[model samples]
Target: MSERTDPRVVVLTVLLQLAQEARQADTLDAFAFVAANSLKRLVPFRNAALWTDRPARSGVSAVSGVAEIDPDSPAMIWLDALCRHLAEDTSTTGPMGVRPENIPPELEPQWTEWGGPFALWLPLRHPSRQVVLGGVWIIRDTAFNGAELALLERLGEALGETLSRHLRIGTTRSAILAALTRRRLAIAAAIFLLALFPVRLSVTAPAEIAARDPMVLAAPRDGVVARFFVQPNQMVKAGDKLFELDDVDVRNRHELAIRDLAIARTDHKRANQAAFADPQSSAELSILANRIERAQAEEIYSRELLARSEVVAEKNGLVIFTDPADWLGKPVKTGERIALLSDPEKVEVLAWLASTDAIVLRSGAAVRMFLNTAPLSPLKASLESASYEAQMSPAGVLSYRLKASLAEDEPPPRIGLHGSARVYADNVPLIAWILRKPLATLRQLVGL
Candidate 1:
């Protein structure tokens, strides 16, 4: 086999070289490398300077390794103008705009200076799609034939494809790196939130007021039934007589005893006087005085019996219960209870709550209570540091007693007022709402 030296072969070989150059350069610096190396194989200007045109910019980097030249240099200015023309044409006519024979007069001077009569300006397309993005100007010494021009066009195409591939890779890599950085910041933000905002814990329960039951008043000794002066539920002051028993018999006995006492006194005085008058008669007088003293003792006993007829209240309260109204005229036994009284102003609100709903109940919890009849208003209350012993309600339902005290501004909750209380507990994590019951059950069973 013989190596083909035909122009077509040359063109194909050079185009392949250009594509390889672009593919090899991964970074933006590879642009300089690609332009420099790819241009070396073709017959172009002796020394090539890559010129990129902005509004007023000239030559940027040189492929021929020449000394830096002023951007204002005539040759450099012409090169920039040529690049600008190529850029404009490619923008309008797509990537195949620049060809060797179409060189304008103003750009000729720069081509001549760079040592090329025919040159090709190829546009580097963006990685997104096939289009003329920027121009790649090549320098050649002589006017090239159609075959050479065709070769340069093919080289441009390969360069465009390669550049597009690299641009896509660069864009994708940048996007991935940005995404990673963003994710890291998000994680940090979550951690910061956890530290700055902490969860709080608190105890909660319903409350109610409690009072001691009324003290019992009972008879201390056996006595006849007294005549009652007041009816049930009547209020009485301490020391006021509540009932009076018949004392006629005891009163008569007391009067007889009083007369006997007076007679005893007279006899004792006579005995003493007799002893002073005559020693011989003193013994008989003393015997009479002894009998008088025995009679006087009986009189004192009758008087005491008469004084026990009246009954009195021990404390101030309404008379809660009275057995039979006619019992006042009958005999009464010792230790018999007369009445029951309870404090009125110091009453408590006994709120019954379902056991399941009372799970959050705890001492010191704050609550708001509203009577069933007074639903429009609420009274503030606090847990009274105690709870009722758990028991079944009258209706056979499990419930707990919540004792609450009215706040300073509120009136004491009247006894027997049916009301409900709302207790405030600390906020918990949102997830706990679903898991609260199961967790509580587990803890109870495991004793954890």
Candidate 2:
């Protein structure tokens, strides 16, 4: 039995050729190429083309037997339109045969113009579903017999499976498209929310509560803290003794000035009485008067120093020191700090925004704080001020100081309480909010 005469031999040969090409194909384009050049031998055609309608792509992939239909030719456009019309209905679950006679009357003129004067289309669909994958257009004069159609019908299933197997996109695009389209209302709602809704563009930072009126008492003059009148955090009233300076030295000086003034005044009075009796005594009286004036000035200064010996609270508040022992016997310079007189009720949040994340924070921006002690019960506040310069935070991270005022009605956070805060800033789109950071990072790295 000759190969040409034997239908079984021809079919087997064509199958082997197609299998080899199928194995070599890596993409949808390559698969389409293999189908175009190889399938014609079994179902002979004068002109043939393969097309697909996958995501992000649509049009002809491969052509065979016709060199006349070039890219710039009008025939390509007509062919595309013709195939698109046929592929509109994806219910063609499997490969289906069609002849020139089956071509709809509305499409006949176009079919004659581009695809072919006489042709057949084998519409291929997803192997497992009703969705149309693509089709093969073959131009031939002879009609397909039962044996030829049978051969193609038996093999079309495998061909569709091969197309599916080789396709990189697969059903993922369709699935996503279906999800987006089926829940169109949800998509519209999301778009609407993104466009109209004003979300907070917040910057998170480490924070703590600080007293608004923190009165720090500094040493009036050089002295050692001789004694502490109260313990740490002890509540005190105005004029209450807070601590005492080592005033023994100051007292001695005060006594010396007082004794010196008394002696100078006594001497000056004697000189004045003598001035009336002797001319030399008048010169002595002038010298004594000068000495008496110097003594009085000295006396006044010494008394002022002695008065400052006892440190007192000028305003009402708790002593804001951790340990009284820290101040005991410690020698301090003039104007050296001692302790803070802080009203626990008068407090504000001091947040440190990282240098990298800091933005132009306006006054009265929204602020939400969460203390380490009470993470769940968030306290609300508003931005009061932001530092013009960056500084190192307590943790050593470079940050900008941001001030905020907690709502008065909300329980005032304890003075010196540590926490974290989110400072709300300028508005941005929802997509921008999600992607801006990543895009910014990418631009920095890639310099795009």
Candidate 3:
């Protein structure tokens, strides 16, 4: 029921039977050992070879039996193309025979252009039935006839089956390893999530608020701010004597003016009363009247200077900064700042806004500010004023000044606390909120 067995057929069949058993070996090393021995015994070719496709490897054969198959050899052109084509087509029988139509255009030229006189291709079929496992290529210079072709077919089939089996085992082994790794990672993540893992956030450039108190205590006279009776942070009421300057010279001048005025007044009264009785008293009366006027003017000026010596607080507030204690004896000019006081309760929140946001910020827009130290608690406020012009920040970013008054009563804010606020605007999608920057960058680059 079949072609009669010739001596060559008998020997080839027996060797192939043994080779199939040896090729059936599980390990690639074992399969290779069995295949080489079988090929040498069955065929008269000077050299026998086996090839396989390896992940992430390119050019020439990744796994090869022949040492001459250099990794970078140009001879790999045919093998590479054959392997790629076979890797995609899993249904076809490898090395049984291939029509010119069945061969891909990419490999058609290589079949003729390759240096080898004969070449064999076998698809390493996958056992999972998902896709082609890969392909193997056997090349030689001497062409074979029908009998030799048959032997090569059997060899290719046996090799393909062996590769398929090993590949399945390899796949199973890889899947197990991957599953174990995933389980370990999941456990680690769970443990980390349960512990409330703390994330440390640091800010190199923190937000700053600028503020100032309009109430300032100034020196009332051209005298040193002597005897500073109050220190910074001390509370004082309106009209409280803050400090007193030395008034010894002014007091002495005032006393001298008073004595001169007394003598002039006495002479003027006697001269005026006697003026009607004697004509000579008229001249004396005029001189004494002039002297009394000069004395009164001097006395008034001296009295004003003495009154200015006792400086008093203008309003109720805590003093922020006062003149240096050592500067008590030093002379000071009029209108010089001696101390600063501010009502801590009348506080306003100062914030920086980008020029773009500043344009949209109205005078009554709502704002919620959070101090860096108390991030969880927010201070409600409303925009009171904003500067029209923008200023360049120290880091060269352009921003505009914004001011707001606290809407609720809270503890007095520290002068230099870092803070930020959300000036409510229109809401957007969550995806847009997260990927806005990256998407904007891509759009800019691609001109989309």
lDDT of 3 at 229: 74
Shift of residue 436 alpha carbon in model 3, Å? 10
Q: Count the backbone clashes (under 3 Å) in each candidate.
A: 10, 0, 0
Better of 2 and 3 by lDDT: 2
Reference-based lDDT, residue 357, model 3: 37
- Per-residue alpha-carbon lDDT of candidate 3 for residues 208-236, written as tens digits (9 for 90 to 100): 44335547777777876557777766789
Best by TM-score: 2
Return whichever of 1 and 3 wins on TM-score.
3
Better of 1 and 2 by lDDT: 2
Across 1-448, the per-residue lDDT of candidate 2 in tens digits comes to: 7645786886888877776677678776667767787787677778778877766667776788543345455666667767887788566543455644565676666655554545666676665554566777777677667777666655565666677665643577468656778799788987878776666688789999887868998888988999988887788999999988999999999999999999999998888888888888888987888898999999999999989888899988978876778888999988988888988778899999988786778999999999999999989999999889899998999989889998977898778788899888898767766776788778779988
Report the CA-based lDDT of candidate 2 relative to the real structure: 0.78
> For candidate 2, which ten residues in a row score worst on lDDT?
65-74
Question: Which lDDT values do the candidates have, in the order given?
Answer: 0.61, 0.78, 0.65
Per-residue lDDT of model 1, residues 266-358, tens digit only: 877877787878886687776777777788778777877777767677777655555647566666666787655556556555565656555
True-vs-predicted CA distance for residue 402, candidate 1, Å: 3.5
